[model samples]
Target: MPQTLKTLGPKAAADLDGDLMSDAGGFSIDQLMELAGLSVSQAVYNVHPPSAGNNGGDGLVAARHLYFYGYTPVVYYPKPTKKPIYDGLVKQLNNLHIRFDNETPFDKLAGESDLIVDALFGFSFQPPVREPFDQAIAVMEKGVKPVLAVDTPSSWHVEDGPQNEGLGSKYMPDYLISLTAAKPNVGHFKGKKHFIGGRFLGEDVAKKYNLNIPEYKGLDQIVEVPVDVKVEKL
Candidate 1:
């Protein structure tokens, strides 16, 4: 029998926010970030188990997860002084004794990576990409390595998806690992694979938001989302 797929519009997807970072429940941001990072690491390992290169917000956390699982990961980021977030991320990396290089250029790092994690931006990023990140994203987009985007693809509009349709192929990710819930921008995801992680949302919250998300059967903390399916009401 043919499987009946499920789909959610961008708006509905956006409304489904279960990220532990959000005040949706009692979980701390750090706790949620850890879970989110672990999910991403496992997804990448499942498909492409090799040394990785990561950039952006969740990249550092993801990198740490990879290291814990005995994978080699090279993280690229602006100096901690450039972004306040990097300050804590760097400390965490140092504390865990994970390998990273914030000074090397993206082009040079791109060559070393077997897979790239586009954690350069989250669901909150607005377009135009700005400065160093813009250049870095361009380099990664042009690279031959497959990319797994964390949350949303870098440089893509959160609500509208990729702004430049012409460059869609260039910037599109091979895989997307959405945390908590799928973001609206994921409706624009051109990836071959999409997975939902951060399965900690309570039933009440899910109902209040009308998330309409499916259950993660068995011991799965992450589940694949089929494309072009009919919407199923939760």
Candidate 2:
């Protein structure tokens, strides 16, 4: 039921996600992020087991699950968040002994990794790519390995595509895992696979938005959108 699924714009997507994390939706931020990250990890498992590296909680959440699912995930978080939740996530990974590589160059990680999880930014991001991420995305933009963007790719417009100047001519992601629902920018993704995740939506939010999320089969946390080959027309 591809036609049943709805796509939200940046603001709508952000609002919906906010609702899902708030008490109104009956979910804690960490709980939702954990599910979001799990959804991301499940998507990556289909193509590259044990992956989904990001500095965001989603990335940290993903790396933890990937580790349990049997992938030795290495994190390349250049800009770590100071928030308690994010810090706790990093701590959990550290306790798990997951490797954090702020020292290694992006090119080196890109060359060595089987799949790069583009969790540098998410739906909440608004920017022209700041500091270290700006430099990292530059290297990632030219990489040969496949990439699996968590929600929004770094520096990409939440509602649009990579209209950011430096991002326009760059290489696109190989796979994209859309959290909560697909964003409008999925229409511009030239990736091989597009998935809808963040499966923790409550009826209040979904009904409020009239979202028609496809059912995740069995116990699966994520489902393929069948838009593989290219999501540009989504």
Candidate 3:
């Protein structure tokens, strides 16, 4: 039997996004990036076991350096400018004084860090990545360490899943922070990819159509325009 992709229910989507966006003192991109950093950091722990001693932590053996890959210049290219995660993301890294680099050669990024945060692509990418980005993606696929894709990794025909009418599958993320309410059936047609089952969205927004980082209340609010709902006059 073919492996199946799980559906994200409304409550589940809200729960995921809410957990990230909701803060007592309103929302900010810095907060979101901080949450994301922590999330990726934890994911690091999940993949690599804690060190034998030194209080059972990874014990600094795993490199602290984290690299971000993406087209920062045009985070919202072809789309209207809006609040983006890129700014807060880099700022958060700087605040933490984390050794982070951006838009480097994919191989260099792959080799330099123990973990890679794949922010190279977002939901905005409708057409396939051509040329340099494609080459870069190919390199990313070769890294030995675990990859934490911000949105989803770039892949072929991922958007053209069997269930385009059902749920659309962009690129698959090893782990996904859905940003806002998880789109129902959004990733149902992931071909042969294996995604760990925990995707979250921002709770503040009702939907998450654009990548703009809006004030949220957890991952439990509407963040974007809901894609065309399958009409069912019941």
Highest lDDT scorer: 2
TM-score for each model: 0.79, 0.89, 0.44
Output the TM-score of candidate 1.
0.79
How many clashes would you count in candidate 3?
35
User: What overall lDDT, based on C-alpha atoms, would model 2 receive against the true structure?
Assistant: 0.75
Residue lDDT tens for model 2, 1-234: 645446788778768767876767778878888898889888878867433442212288888988888777889888788899999999999999998888877777777677788888877777677778866678668866777888777778877678546553474878888888777777777778888887777666778877766688988988787653333222
How well is each residue in 1-234 modelled by candidate 1, as lDDT tens digits? 114333334455445433433575677656766677777887787667644333322377778877767677777776344565657877888888666676777777777767788887766676677777766677757756678888778888765678664333367778888776666666666668888777676787666665544577776667887744442322
Model with the higher lDDT, candidate 2 or 3:
2
Error of 1 at 33 (Å): 1.3
Regions of model 2 farther than 4 Å from truth: 50-58, 228-234
Candidate 3 wrongly placed segments (more than 4 Å): 1-37, 49-92, 95-97, 100-104, 130-132, 156-234
For candidate 3, give the lDDT of residue 10: 42
The local distance difference test score of each candidate is 0.67, 0.75, 0.37
lDDT winner between 1 and 2, please give it. Answer: 2
Which candidate order results from sorting by lDDT in descending order?
Answer: 2, 1, 3
